[model samples]
Target: MYVAVKGGERAIDNAHAWLAEERRGAPDVVELSVEQIREQLAIAVNRVMAEGSLYDPDLAALAIKQARGDMIEAVFLMRAYRTTLPRFGTTFPVDTGQMRCVRRVSATFKDLPGGQILGPTFDYTHRLLDFKLAAEGDVTLAPEATEAAPEVPHVTEFLNSEGLIEEECRTDAEPPDLTREPLETPASRALRLQTLTRGDEGFLLSMAYSTQRGYGRNHAFVGELRIGVVSVEMDIPELGFSIAIGEIELTECETVNQFKGSKTEPPQFTRGYGLVFGQSERKSISMALVDRALRWKELGEDDSGAPAQDEEFVLYHADNVQATGFLEHIKLPHYVDFQSELELVRKLRREVAAKDEVT
Candidate 1:
């Protein structure tokens, strides 16, 4: 481990102590509990979990509190903490078709098999803030539904039946883990999906928006967007059967983009898929769009030279943790490097002045 020099250790320690004091805020105000952050600031906690690639809400909330609500910093903390976790057996792929959906909607259809469920959404709410919340901090409970929720089929299943949309088949091939392996060029769809799931939401959103603005337009229609909890199951060697490990909330988006047809094959609607942890509709939708844009070559479409279409660019810069670390490193002590540059500049100026005088 590297040790700080020239009283830098004491300064660093003092800074940390001061940071903790600031995080605590005024002593008069009640200290925010981890449970409160996990429950009330749930969206923020969700974002941290999604980007951190960890599913523990409590840990994410703790990271958020420790980082003083700086999202990138919280994500960095979560990621760093995640590295210390011991390896566990992987769970079977979650069947989202069996999701106990809290929110489900389809832009492609007026009504689908499961019907639209606008569960606890802010879509209809006005932009104005509620002053009552600031004063009272309480809201009435929502009315319970009298009827049981119905089973929902995937929106793409309708298009697939009509032989309009391309079919997706299950594969036994193991997918590359972005966290465990070095990302390579020409990544598989699975690898790409893994990267996009944990990618910076803002970067993906910007790239997706660019596509809608005609940078590399695919004319995407949100076939379905669903948020819910799905059971995670793992096979036990001794038990000889898969058992439920737990449940995780996920947001899944499926986008039907412009069709691709070739001389050998008939035209079929292309698809882009996004699945992320928590109820992040915006992130899931943006991920779907960017996923489609990056599939130009795979879908046999012409590359319009769009930034989103560039896989290397998207994958390399999508990780906020890596990006922030590199960017923040320049803020650290660089006195030696700056001094060398300063000396070089001064010598160059003196040499130029001496030459001018001689001439």
Candidate 2:
């Protein structure tokens, strides 16, 4: 045991040095800059920001670089770094209706008020790889549009105007912060949304997919999905008014679900909303679906006993940082614990042998 403890400090230092060398890779190859990661690998950066619960692209990029492109590890690093920063003030809820949208679409409508701006989507792209991108070469600039895109209205608005969709109940109460407060079972919709926003994309996607495969079918249709930049504003006590702090890119998805009418209410469409940091359409869509499934109880529907509908299960396991930490810690030193287990097994075997001889 003493020998096992000896030189542990030196070994750890050497291991760290080796890790740094590995992270750098071959000396002949040019190292990737944080800026390059920020711009080119923007999706990965966005995912890290969303899961990390931090909005700094630069820091997320640096964390990605340091983590050697391991997204979960990058998220861990970002979360660690974020905890050290001081909280100033909470921002006012953003008005996404006024977003300067780069991409907006509605599966429910072909020619909506927005005119269906295709934006920068790969929906029409051929999945075949282009050899030109293999080697760096000068690229032709994309043609510019003559005019700006028309303002897109929420697809749900049409349903609302027709009285076909349920009106959202609003409250004046402040939303609970999941980071500051411990997560409780049977969480409120606001707290659940907060947890889902910070949940692992893969986990949420799988949960969402399960619903589509009939685990807890809600008959969801994408009402509208938009990606754009929105200004974050904070009210200043001294000024007695709100001021724009910064702009952040966000993707919002609204799913219209088919709902059977209750005795008191007429049959109307219900909605699931998702708003996530950066342009993460897939995550946003998945979040919306999962959100809808979780709302079964509130909608006066019977629970299908789906995993997504289990509030405690979903909320408790959604955090990749917490899940990974518990999982990876087992790889650390467990010598004493293992030794005790081994001794117990040996003693059990000896007792069995003695019993057999006596019999």
Candidate 3:
């Protein structure tokens, strides 16, 4: 058996010093700034914030920079730092209905009260590489003409009018925090949504894709996808009223799934919901689809046994940091365990040889 080596401290120290130098790159090269990351790499920052469960753009950008653009690592940094902060109070539930939207679209309806406002989106952009950015450090663009967008009513509202959709309910129930408590199976709807919102985007996306490929297809359409800022308020016990604390940019998606019915109830459209920080439409929509798939039990649908439909499976595996930690731990020292297994295998081989000789 191989013996364990001693004294790794010096090597570890030297390795860290080398890592620091590598992270900084060459002395002659210009370093990336946190502000640049916050502004230019806003999508990355948004993802960090979403998974980190902390909405500070500046902090998220700093985490991204410190992590060297490893998004899951950045999220880990933000989440770890957030634990040092003390909670002052909880904010009242955000009213997405009052959100002043930048982008609003409906796949179900042709025209709504507010015309489709296509904000800064690359949905229709040609994906061809723009080499102009290589020569020019920065390019100025003409100012956009602004027109006030009218209030957009939710597409689900139209379905509700005809009683063809499940009734939306907002309860005054307190949600269980996964961060604060151990995760339990058969999770509540609120907990499931919370987990999905902070889940690894890529994992969630892949799971949602699986459903689309007929694993547990729910036939979801983007009833409405909106991104905008909404005011956050907090109740002051002494003041006996709630006051506006600040505003946060959020992306909200409401998905209309296939109709569900039984002999007792009429067929009505089911709903899936997703909300996240910043302009993460893809994540939001994917989240909604996955959410609806997980709600198969409540909707009286058969369990297709899809991964996304498995609450325990999805919730347990959705955290990238946790998954990476367990997965990457294989790189650590396992000499003792390996040696034990080696001895067992050798003993078994010896026994087999003896038995063969006897035969």
Candidate 4:
């Protein structure tokens, strides 16, 4: 306390240098290659991409490494990077119906026109830790496929054919970008789905779980979950027609929720939709359930005063990056305010003592 605090600039520079060093780790140790991080730590990359709303795997991987594997911090990094990117023209809605599926499954039906494929999942794995991964990893060969299968149509399409679920109208309307536009009340299904897609995975999961636990229970079943690469098309004004822009991996979930018949209309099963970047089934499923819960007003269901049913609460607080930034910012600097409060408390204490003495 007695020594004068000098070298503020140098101290800041040193701190930055130390931080960079810490991020990189030992010089002698093998550095984590970006490819390694993308392939091996795909879940982290998926979370970053989903929350960041940016699809670059390499950048997500780099951000994950720089953030020291903190998913929220990685998402923050990706979001920061995303803000600086120049906007290209928007793409037409992805034709998920035509997606070349890597994995497709349905919980509502045992078998459908397109057979269920388990694909790649850790769902059946035991909780035990694998010690072999701590040492040099063993490479495994790719499994050979024995048969070719027909393309799987969406499960909701089957329901649509029978007119069981509400028919979704196809439109030429462009959906609002949540990143560019401020979220307004009474959001469209597109906007709501967009918010939920990038929402905090754990938070959405808990909210979805709450729905099953009877807080505004919708009795949701995974009507269909599909993961695959889909063609992204854009309308070139000059060409006067849409053309393929690029392809991206996506996870799409559709949930069937119970609906009560209203006075005007017959009770039919309603749909909740969730679509996200990459192969994130869990997050997508959670998003679908939460989406349904938020649709209470639109579906003419009573507002049950549940957190999941609150659109503002769910949409605003769902992003882990925003939550973490606001929550952790308190650690930055508040000493001046604290000192003022401390002085006020001390003054009040002295006045109380003086009053006691007089008494």
Candidate 5:
């Protein structure tokens, strides 16, 4: 292929101009507002915030709009934006037990302390697409309960009472941040969880599906799935008090998996925890399944050599920005490299033909 000798800057500028025009599409159509994307296309914003590791919904929404609804691109933008900001004091770990739950469901128990709430789910909705909603409609939702759920009793707490599940331990050890440090093999459970929470949803979904397909089968039951807003508090050293910073929506999933006791330990059910920003139930649940599958070695079980179980493989390839950069770099100029390969291939062919003729 012929390589362009010049005009890299000019070509780039023109391409960007065309892209900008394309992004706007036809000006005749009503432009979509950032608020519309924030409130209406909330799932996209949630995914961006979760993957981007930022909790600002408005900023996330703006990123989504600027990225033209491309979630990975939005996440990329948010991550880039996040680096420019100064790090204030660290917030206390959110108390999910006291979360004002918008939705709570448990497969383990039909009747728990808090009854199953099927709130704001599409589980019962038909898959058929409605053409009527193509243009925005002025339909209003009927008001229901104004009262918030006081507290959600954890599903694991019940199993823990009888020693049926693994205990949830609180650790003050600061988890190593992958962004700030290079990821090492045999990662700590805390670090692994941090990676999984920010991992690509599609990748996690596939990894979880592989487990069900006998890749690393761990019989998992969704012990609890809760989506709600939780208060974020930070301890102020000067004030000598903890103050509420803000509230952010979170989707937390706890998957209980069957485990037979190893030679060193007694049999007990294991738990995989997934806590992500916003109402990302599917991603959160998928994360939990994958999280459980990765714990085989730590639990004293044999390594099944599954892709999800490989910390190096999952953590490295899970970031879309990193993956996409290497992927998209293929489209850039490779003339010199291609020409070298081409000449080598032709030289080998000529040698082979000459040897055949001589023979």
Candidate 6:
């Protein structure tokens, strides 16, 4: 007996109701507030913002709570929310050279123009679990203010002064938005960088690591990694002037890579750039390395057939939302296809048996 089930709408409604209950949890347990998530689970919030391409910590936190702490789901929620937002105006490209950095470090030079500030990093901290954190939080005093330091220009600027690094031309061209249009082959540098910013951090890290392992080894040095807030300004056509719309936290990484000069050009250092939303230095640094690896052909370096060197491969697999959606959609019903295959196999066997007997 074939029982035709038809309750798609009802099922969806029930699922949503259940999800709402799950997100809320027990009444006595106190619901997780957006502010609490933003303040307490800052790292998770940072990851959400980085992948979401939205800098609002509050919205990221809310998405996180709604998604039951699933960072990728939170990122998806943010992306969906951002898509509905109407375009007010475009911001001029932020000059990272003018960034008032909270944390700035360079691995290339020991003593550069701007002294390295390690800032708040867990790199040196032991991996051991702290039982005290589970019981109670510790209060620490704020450091005394010191004299303001001079604005540090980019390290690449110094290299450019000596004709060592590749000089980037100042262009007034507007870059294409990846979200608004379908990505085509032979993407512009701007599009590539935009894709990399919201790309999966682990995937980018592994690709970058593969390059270091001689897959497409272009000797790379972290020229600079800076995390700070930058003002976003938009030009008002009616007013004939640019105004500060808002401020967003950003992490920018610039990598200096070795390049052999061609016949026409002199031997000089090339650069790879990564700029992402929020305090996501790891993602930004990984992005920078991958960016350089992908530019092997442009820099006159031979393609070593590395995954990072393949733009189609890298860009296609970077976004978690796209990857996850296609992956999870398989969970939906495919019984009809399975049953057809089953019937075909049975028919083939019956025919073969009948033919053998007739022979």
Off by over 4 Å in 5: 1-5, 145-147
Model with the higher TM-score, candidate 2 or 3: 2
Residue 136 error, candidate 6, Å:
2.9
Instruction: State TM-scores per candidate.
Output: 0.96, 0.96, 0.95, 0.92, 0.96, 0.91
Indicate whether candidate 1 or candidate 6 has the larger TM-score: 1
Local distance difference test scores for all models = 0.91, 0.90, 0.89, 0.86, 0.88, 0.85
The lowest-lDDT stretch of 10 consecutive residues in candidate 2 is 144-153
What pairs collide in candidate 5? none
Better of 1 and 4 by TM-score: 1
Q: Using alpha carbons, what is the TM-score of model 3?
A: 0.95
Which of the predicted structures, 3 or 6, would earn the higher TM-score when compared with the native?
3
lDDT of 1 by residue, 1-359 (tens): 11356777787789889999999999999999999999999999999999999999999999999999999999999999999999879999999999888888899999787789888789999999988898966677778863425558999999999989987856999888888998998999899988998999999999999999999988999999998889999999999999998999999999998776866557888899999999899999999999989988877788899999999999999999999989988987787899999999999999999999999
Where does model 4 exceed 4 Å of error? 1-6, 135-137, 145-150, 169-171, 354-359
Name model 3 segments beyond 4 Å from true: 1-5, 140-142, 145-151
Evaluate model 4: give its lDDT. Answer: 0.86
Number of clashes recorded per candidate: 0, 0, 0, 0, 0, 0
TM-score of predicted model 5?
0.96
- Model with the higher TM-score, candidate 4 or 5: 5
Question: Which of candidates 1 and 4 is the stronger one according to lDDT?
Answer: 1
Q: Per-residue lDDT tens digits of candidate 4, residues 1-359?
A: 11224766677778889998998899999998889999988877988999899999999999999888988888989989999999878887778888888788898889887788777778788989988778878856558763323457899888888878877755668888899988887788888888888889999999999989988888988999988888889989998998998889899999987787676657788898888888888899999999889988877889899889998888888878778879988876576799999999999999999999999
State model 2's lDDT. Answer: 0.90
Each model's Cα RMSD: 1.7, 1.9, 2.3, 2.9, 1.9, 2.8
Evaluated at residue 21, the lDDT of candidate 6 is 94
